[model samples]
Target: MTSTSGARSHTSPWELYDGLTALVPRGVTVTTCVVSRWALVETDAGGAGLSSVPDDGRDDPHGPQDVVGQDLADVAALVRSWDRRLAAIGLASINAWCNTQERLEAHAGDVIDWDASAFERSGELVQGRRVAVVGRFRHLDQLASRCDLTVLERRPQGRDLPDAAAEFVLPEVDHAFITSMTLANKTLPRLLELSGGARTTLVGPSTPLAPEAFAGRVDEISGSLVYDAPWCRRALMQGQGMASMRGALTLFNLRVPA
Candidate 1:
């Protein structure tokens, strides 16, 4: 088990944000945007993307509710905001723009498997190798037998390392399965650097499936594309968690071409 020696970016969010902002259509007003316990947005074309926003957003005073009718390009720019609530909404917009709104960007030579989970795919490749899953995703138990596995979380639970341990742990791993929330928290750039040459997959529903945005930054993109926007929006508004997304979402993996 070994980690790669350089970083994809010491400065992140911008390089990634720049790529996504360029992809989102200009002047297209978003149809729906909400941030209660979860942040979600839908493009005018029925595309939906979701983010886990823990804050109730009731007291933020300044929020992105006005983003519904705003230019998406300007909305996408919010991903760079330092305010956590604003950043959460911004990420939701980017996910909606990149994954759902721009589904036509099937880059040539890129292969997307619609029925696979990132956990399963990552497990297949980590046999007897060192792996670090930066989020506390379920099913790590299934992977423990095949690899030297480690789990890190912002709120450490069980044996998982604290998120800060990435500086020490990521540089020594072979594969890093990073959570998409790293983008919202603006920790992704540094995490990528720590993972260096290690094969990496940006894993979560919050991930923007923009290959161009992540070219050379990651090896694979594993995320969900919401097929039923209304259903997801309703669910998010009704306080449903990710586990309750009954058939409204489809998980996919896009293997970035080398």
Candidate 2:
């Protein structure tokens, strides 16, 4: 008989939020928060974090769009308490902000500067397996040449499959590369559910490095850390993307312990 256990194998954003919030100690105050091309948060403790700013401001279900004036600690605490569908992007940024501080204080030793490319690490794992990529990446051309690959984009472009294909194609693949923006869009849980037996990985600049948040559901978490918050903020405020801003970021990866 197939053994049925406790909650199904998936990482709920709320679960991640709970795990993340537990690490945040009291008395830490938010020093600054800016939402431009990128959402940025800096705590009084000199820790900073960045994320893709949420769009659809008009459709945000959480009260108003004026989160600019709220308390950082209060906003961070409320992030875990809200329904995932409400003001999702904003919540994602807030979570990233809180997680940055928490990781700086607690997991400082675990955060290391990565010299290798994330695509190389991903390519090594999918050697002979079919691959399903959830978001478009510039390095995809390298991977496509080696294996059968399907790329699903929210806005289908060129050869990319539409988002609907995720449910149909993900289960059949041997490995998957899912974007960390899924958390901002409130699709991470569902994507993880669709991942099935694939060695699934969450990849992007927006991903949080909170291992406890990912736990068993994710095989790897590849994301960025703010190396120079002031520079990043200035570029973001000037409408430049992450790539346009140099020396402001560092890439990092966390493999889930087996």
Candidate maximizing TM-score: 1
Off by over 4 Å in 2: 1-13, 54-71, 77-113
Estimate the lDDT of model 2: 0.64
TM-score of every model versus the real structure: 0.89, 0.80
Residue-level lDDT for 26 in candidate 2 = 59
C-alpha local distance difference test of each model: 0.76, 0.64
Q: How well does model 1 score by local distance difference test?
A: 0.76
For model 2, what is the alpha-carbon lDDT of residue 176?
78
Best-matching candidate per lDDT:
1
Residue-wise lDDT of candidate 2 within 119-184, one digit each (tens)? 766665666679889987777888887778999987879989998889899778877788876776
Q: How far in Å is the alpha carbon of 211 misplaced in model 1?
A: 0.5
